[model samples]
Target: MNFKHMTAAAVFAGLIAGCNVMGTPLPDPRLSGRDAEFMALAPQARVNSQFERYLVDYKTNEPVGSIIVDNNAKFLYYVMPGGKAVRYGVATGQDAMAFTGRAYVGGMQEWPRWIPPKDMLERWPHLQPTADAGGLPGGPDNPLGSRALYLYQDGKDTLYRIHGTNEPDKIGQAVSSGCIRMRDIDAIDLYNRVKVGTKVVVL
Candidate 1:
């Protein structure tokens, strides 16, 4: 096997070994820096076992670098070679606001500034004051958290994104306006993995 395949095998083995052992908790694959300060400040949430990253027996026609959002399952799968995928928990849009169909990752940003969309401003008029003053700066209080992957279709901005959130507790629930939400650490991990032009399928 090539280097990539060998690396995947090692990761898969580690994941399998991490399952349900009665000792220390498995190291979270998503958290890069293990920032204790950030963890202390971030909202605490109980992450279900299914939401954690694992080596899944995913069979898909899509090539590597594709993303599949299973809305019903509240899971996001990043397709990998060798019939494997890295699954993550995601919070999707509410029933009427959920996005379906296909798009591609058009752009990416780190600690992105959030400009509240016009519709959002109309829905939450209270934000109009901030809307008048440019946009929210990137920080722990910013809704966009640490990373963002902008979605597009036919090279036009879809105004949807997969991004990190300040409120990590909302993950695994349908609470977003239209974009997908992930834990800040998970978002950072995914941001490092994917590139612009990655295909995304929302189902």
Candidate 2:
């Protein structure tokens, strides 16, 4: 109410307005217009765990048919010809008792509509019977992200997916309930290279 108090309040407000507070910086504004980076399949050029790195099969490994999931490392290796493999960051099951064993890529979908499973509804009472309540449209927010590869075994849905996530930061971690997650761009790239009936081995 006093002049001194008002002045202090104004300073504080200006500080916030000028990004003085310590917090996560917003995603790059320049990157916002680059929707293709968030939506389209692009080449993985970097190496190691860096954001730009995408492991590809080389030498003896080259998506030779066998796929191995190093869940511990949060990396999926598609064994390629020679001695090379395509390593990809992935978001795996949150629980230690998550998906294991073998499966195949039964089908693929783009910007697939997500339908919450019955169990998900049971666990979250607020969840609706259909995806409309929480399901995000096929775009930036969809949990399934830009692309999805349906995992199946013995001609049955494993209730698991090897898909893309909007939260690329969560990649290379154990976070999802029961899905193999990757960055949206990386997933799109992998989707194009893989096909139906590709055997996947998750360890």
Candidate 3:
């Protein structure tokens, strides 16, 4: 594969894991110092960050077919037919998260385990101790947080995930290693709404 394709695949693959359990959480990243001040305004302010809206339009009220991620708006929409979409606030992948195409929801899980990556272990020697220590239990601190939706295409793993995050403040920003993240509550809500084999469009 050429650089663009390779880059895209790597980006999607990193997102697939959603969160890192063995490594330390990355530092908060805002677009600018002004963005930092905006974050400091309060949790409500963070949650209420301005984001563009796009309503779904079609035949049925149920979102039976596809999931769309509007990266710029920091919103994930499950497209239901008949002019309806379930929108969720999201935290996106940082420098590495850049999947621009189609994939399928191959599997879904609740309170999933987390295994740190080799590079993460290399970066943080402490992670080496936990590399073989097994997956972390699900709960407040688990990187994967509450839920995970794995993305796959053509019978292969795409390595991108739309999962829940513990940090509600991180929504609408780029911070994670490379995952389409959502608040725990919102994730559970979306989790209940989606199923295996759903179509996912990450652009």
> In terms of lDDT, which candidate is strongest?
1
lDDT for each candidate structure? 0.82, 0.69, 0.67
Per-residue alpha-carbon lDDT of candidate 3 for residues 60-120, written as tens digits (9 for 90 to 100)? 3334557888777677887766566766668787756556578888989876777776656
User: Candidate 2: worst 10 consecutive residues by lDDT?
Assistant: 22-31
Which digits, one per residue and each the tens of the lDDT, describe model 2 over residues 58-109?
A: 4433258666777877877666566656666687887754689989999898
lDDT of 1 by residue, 31-122 (tens): 43534445446665677767756557688988898999998888898887888777888999999989999999999998788989998988
Mark the regions of model 3 whose C-alpha exceeds 4 Å error after superposition.
1-46, 49-64
Better of 2 and 3 by lDDT: 2
Task: State the local distance difference test value for candidate 3.
Answer: 0.67
Q: Which candidate achieves the best TM-score against the true structure?
A: 1
Ordered list by TM-score, greatest first: 1, 2, 3
Candidate 1 TM-score over all chains jointly: 0.81
